[model samples]
Every structure is written in C-alpha cells, then in structure tokens.
Target: MHSGLPNGEHALIVHQAGDLSNSCANVGPIMAPDKKFNVSAIFGNIKVDGTKNATIDREIDWPKDISLIGRSLVIHKLSVMEWSLRNKDILPLACGTIGFASP
Candidate 1:
C-alpha cells in the first residue's frame, strides 16, 4: 500500500466487519474468531520507506476457518510495537475491504 504517511512502521490489521461506513471506527474489533485476541487478527507492521510505500511480499498465515473475504483491512497510524507499549487506541489511517482478485 502507498500513502502520504510519515516514513515509519505502521500497524496493519483485519477487522471482523467489512463496514467502512464510519471511517475505520465502525469496522468492529479485530477478526478473532476463536476469541484469541492476540493472534490471527494482527498482521504485524508494515514499514513505509522514504517513498511512503509499504509492501508485504510473503503470504500471511491465517486461521483456515476464518475467511478474510468481506472483512476490512486497516492501516493504523502507529506500529504494533508502539501501540502495544503505549496502550493507546488504534488510530486508523486507511482501510479497504478484502476481496477476490480478478482473473
């Protein structure tokens, strides 16, 4: 993903709902199907280079039972490390709903 965000590591997460009606606030909580709050829902951090672009080349491992389709992927203003340490609410910078790619 590319953004005008300051060059730094940011948090990426998958929320339970695909709703973006209220910005990123109404996306509901992280997609923790098994009630495991600390696991699958968090996609860790994405480092934004000087060009303000971030990429994840590797495949992310997620719970097989949980389908990411129709879910919301959110990019947070702070890195997961910073957010966890500071214990602050997630500040979403951008978001998009997950969907299938075209053939």
Candidate 2:
C-alpha cells in the first residue's frame, strides 16, 4: 500500500482500459457481473497506530486475462462492484499503471 491512504475497506482493481496498450485509462473491472477485483485483497485492514500506516502482505491469484503490465490499479472508496454500477464515472482514491520490472 502507498503511504497516503485512508483506513478502510479499499479494493485493488486491475482495469482493462484501452487496447492493452500504454493508453488503457478506462479502469473497468477485470471480471464481469460483479466488478470485484478481489475481496480478500482489502486494503487498510492491517493493524496500525495513530498514523494509520501498515504494510499489506497479500498473495493474489493473478488471473490470466488480466495482465499486470500496461494495466492500471485503482483503489475505490466503496466496493468495486457497487461503485461501478452506482456512479456515472467512478472516482478512485488512488491509482497507478503497472510496468515491467528490470531483471
């Protein structure tokens, strides 16, 4: 998790924005029906002090369809599914585009 984020049930979503290119800014759900990225990957659930800072140690089962590279990670206020359906354009608390790591 980043150093700046409110403490709550934040979801980690991988959006398939464009044609799987560098301009994929859509930020939609990686799955269908319920736009849930991962319920268990809930951020801010860690125990922290007044500063509300804690590291998130989680192992996610990466889906084949959703590639980490060139994709975007969005953190929403509410549940991923709820926010996607209710709002015209979802507002993410924090977001970042995934890139390849140097070997």
Candidate 3:
C-alpha cells in the first residue's frame, strides 16, 4: 500500500461495514460476527517505509466464514499495541472497501 503515512508500523483491520460515507468512523468496529474479538479480526500491522510504502507479498490466512467482499479495510494511525495500550481510539489514516477486480 502506497500511503502518505509516516514511517512506522500502523494497524490494519477489516471493519464489519463497507460504508465510507462518514469517513473511516462509519466503517464500524472490527469484523466480529461472533460478537467476540479474535485473531481473525486482526489483519496485523503494516510497516510503512521511509517512502511511505507498505508491501505484503505473502497471502494472508483469512477465516472462511467471514466474507470481506463488502467490508472496509482500515489503516489506523497507531500500531495495534500502541492503540490498545494508550487509548482505544482507532484513528484511521485511510480506508477502502474490499472488492474483487473486474474481469
């Protein structure tokens, strides 16, 4: 992901809703269909280089039941650990809806 974000590790999560009408805040909470938080909801962290670019060359092991088709991929301002420890405020830096490419 090429972003204007600062060089640091940022949190990546998939929200329940795909809505971006009111910015990332409208994306809703991390996708917890079971009404419980788990490893599935965490997409891990994206390390931004000095050039503000992040690359994930490996395939992510996603849960089969959770469909990310219409969900939103949110890039938080802080890393997962920082956000969890400091404050629960998930300040989003960027957001995009997950979808398949057209043929």
Candidate 4:
C-alpha cells in the first residue's frame, strides 16, 4: 500500500477486525484471534510526505498458523507530540483490509 501519512514516522499494524469486535477496540502488538493490532503482522514503518506521492510497496511474510486473510491494516499516527497535553491514545489515521488478489 502507498503511504498516506504526512512527512513523518508511521507504522502499519494488522488489527483483528473480521470478528465480533472492531479493529480499533482490539489493539495490540502481537497476533491473536481477538486481539486488536498485531505487532507480528506489522509490515514496517515508513516516512512519507503529505504533499507528494511516496508510494510504498510492502511485501507480506504470511504466518502459516495465523489467518489474517480478512484482518484490517491500520495506519497509526506517531510523532513527538506524546509529551504534550493532548490525548495519549494511538490514533488511527486510516484502515485497509487483506484480500485475495484477482486473477
């Protein structure tokens, strides 16, 4: 997927959103059936500019045991504003889902 975040550091995390709960609610740093964001499913971090098109081509190393076929890939906002008075929640900028490639 191409980079949608502004010129800064951002991470792509896989959230379990194809079940009873929503993806944003079940957040985590590891892969699980009911967990939110899976760190193990992270493609990686990327730097992008909001003004220009900085397309990112990510390669997925699928887990043989975990089925993230319909999971959500969420882009998180990470910056130096953590020390500020703003809310410390890791806000999700965007979301995408894993799907089968058409022939």
Q: Pick the candidate with the highest TM-score.
A: 3
Q: Indicate the TM-score of model 2.
A: 0.56
Among residues 3 or more apart in sequence or in different chains, the pairs in candidate 1 whose N, CA or C atoms overlap within 3 Å are: none
Poorest lDDT segment (10 consecutive residues) of candidate 2: 39-48
- Please state the error at residue 64 of candidate 4 in Å: 3.6
Error of 4 at 36 (Å): 20
Per-prediction TM-score: 0.78, 0.56, 0.79, 0.57
Residue pair clashes in candidate 2: 18-24
Candidate 1, after superposition: displacement of residue 10 in Å? 0.5
How high is the lDDT of residue 21 in model 1?
Answer: 77
| Local accuracy of candidate 4 as per-residue lDDT tens digits, 28-58 | 3334543543435655655576674543446
Order candidates by TM-score, high to low. Answer: 3, 1, 4, 2
User: Each candidate's lDDT (Cα)?
Assistant: 0.78, 0.53, 0.77, 0.57
Tell me the tens digit of each residue's lDDT in model 1 across 1-103. 6568777888788888999876678788877767753346778888888877776534677767668899999888888778668754555888889999989
Clashing pairs in 4: 26-36, 27-36, 27-37, 28-37, 29-39
Clashes of each: 0, 1, 0, 5
Native-referenced Cα lDDT, model 4? 0.57
Q: Give one digit per residue, the lDDT tens place, for model 2 in 1-103.
A: 6766676545566665423333333565553312454432233223223576744445566555545676566666555456546763546666677787789
What are the per-residue Cα lDDT tens digits for candidate 3 across 1-103?
Answer: 6458878888887889999876677998888756542446666788888776785423577656667899999888888788667764555889999999989
Candidate RMSDs in order? 2.9, 5.9, 2.8, 6.0
List runs of model 1 lying over 4 Å from the truth: 35-39, 86-90
TM-score (C-alpha) between model 1 and the true structure: 0.78
